[model samples]
Target: MLKAVSLGPGDLSLLTPAARWAVEEAEVVAGYKGYIELIPDEVLEGKIVVSTGMMGEVDRARQAVEHARAGRKTVMVCSGDAGIYAMAGLLMEVLESEGLLKTVPFEVVPGVAAFNAAAALLGAPLMHDFASISLSDLLTPWERIEQRLQAAASADFVIALYNPRSRKRSDHLREALGIIGRYRRPSTPVGMVRKAYRAGQFVEAVPLKAVDVDKVDMQTVLIVGNSATRLVEGRMLTPRGYHRKYAL
Candidate 1:
């Protein structure tokens, strides 16, 4: 059986029971280097490991399947949630067409994604209806992301920004914030979460108007609240708990 597991952002503690089992029992663990490193060396000591350095995502998926077809238990790991802009969706799509579904059993184990971890760092900024949008132009074009940003802002939905920066696409995030700023309030709460799980983590709170575009990189997730969103005390909590309408 082939299992696609999520390591849960960058934090080892967020790994679910199913994901841990899949990793520990697998004979071959295939994933990006960062995720592979997340698992301790002792756990994957004897397993055959494959590392993909950003390019050829589809090729790596094929390689994982070949291992599975050979009756090797393969765990294709991904960062954050497996399905949220991860390898689970693409792998499943191609596998179904190739009839690998009938030959090998597979599972997608859920994990604590970036938005949840980032929101926690900023408080409850996503307590209400929210939308997650990626600024990456690798597959989805920048034009499509721009359209989503405008729609999300106009609808008063809290927005979670993923893949905020890369070498060639550093300015896309700032442009997105600019577009969102036009529709939302200037003081809307914006929370930046860096390395949510791993070491050297940092979280910052900023108003929409005061955000510094230079602080973000590919490892960051930015959460921007709707018009109704506000920073309370030091946290960026969304009011999804209980309303105080009846209170004095």
Candidate 2:
């Protein structure tokens, strides 16, 4: 089976059984270099390995398909969830564009996305109305991102910011925070989750005013909850389930 599985942040524990199976059983494995260490070394012994740095998607997808075509069951891995800006989309795009879908069997194994992991770590920051947007200008434009952030904030929707920053674009996160800060309260709860589920996992909740955008990178996901969001016993859950369930 040609499977695209999510590794769920960087933590091996969060790698679901389905994802593990695809990784272990495959004769060929394709993934980014960051994922090279994440693969179980025992399972990878003697397997055909293909890895690349970030942003080499088209070539990587082609390599995976080449290995799959050579009669090897291939598994392509991505961090966080498979469907959220991961290899699954690129794989499908290549297959569909080349009309290779019928030639190969493919499946997507879901994993815990960064935003969800961050929310859980921060206490239910997404329990109520919320919206998510990726800040990386690599795939989406900054203007479009600004529009979405403004709209989400204006609609009073809690916002989850993904791919907040990277080495090439270090200032994007600060710009995003500035945009949201205009609409959100300075005291609003903001969560930053990094290395989620991985060995060096960290999750912190700070007021909007206290956030240090410079420290944020692609490894981090930032969740900015609406004004109504509260920390109950240090949990970051919004009030949808709690408020609606008990409402008269």
Give the TM-scores of the predictions, in the order they appear. Answer: 0.94, 0.92
lDDT of 1 by residue, 133-221 (tens): 98889889788989999999898899999888977867898899999999988888899999986788989988889999898888889
- Whose TM-score is greatest here? 1
What TM-score does prediction 2 earn? 0.92
Name the weakest run of 10 consecutive residues (lDDT summed) in model 1: 239-248
Candidate 1, lDDT over the whole model: 0.86
Off by over 4 Å in 2: 241-248
Candidate 2 — number of clashing residue pairs?
A: 6
Clashes of each: 6, 6
Candidate 1 Cα deviation (angstroms), residue 51 = 1.6
Evaluated at residue 139, the lDDT of candidate 1 is 80
**lDDT tens digits, residue span 1-248, model 2:** 57888988767777898888888888988989888778768989999889998777789999998787667899998888888878898898887887879988989999998888888788888867889998888767789999998999888899999888866878888888888888888988888988877778878888889998877767788889897887566567677753455645
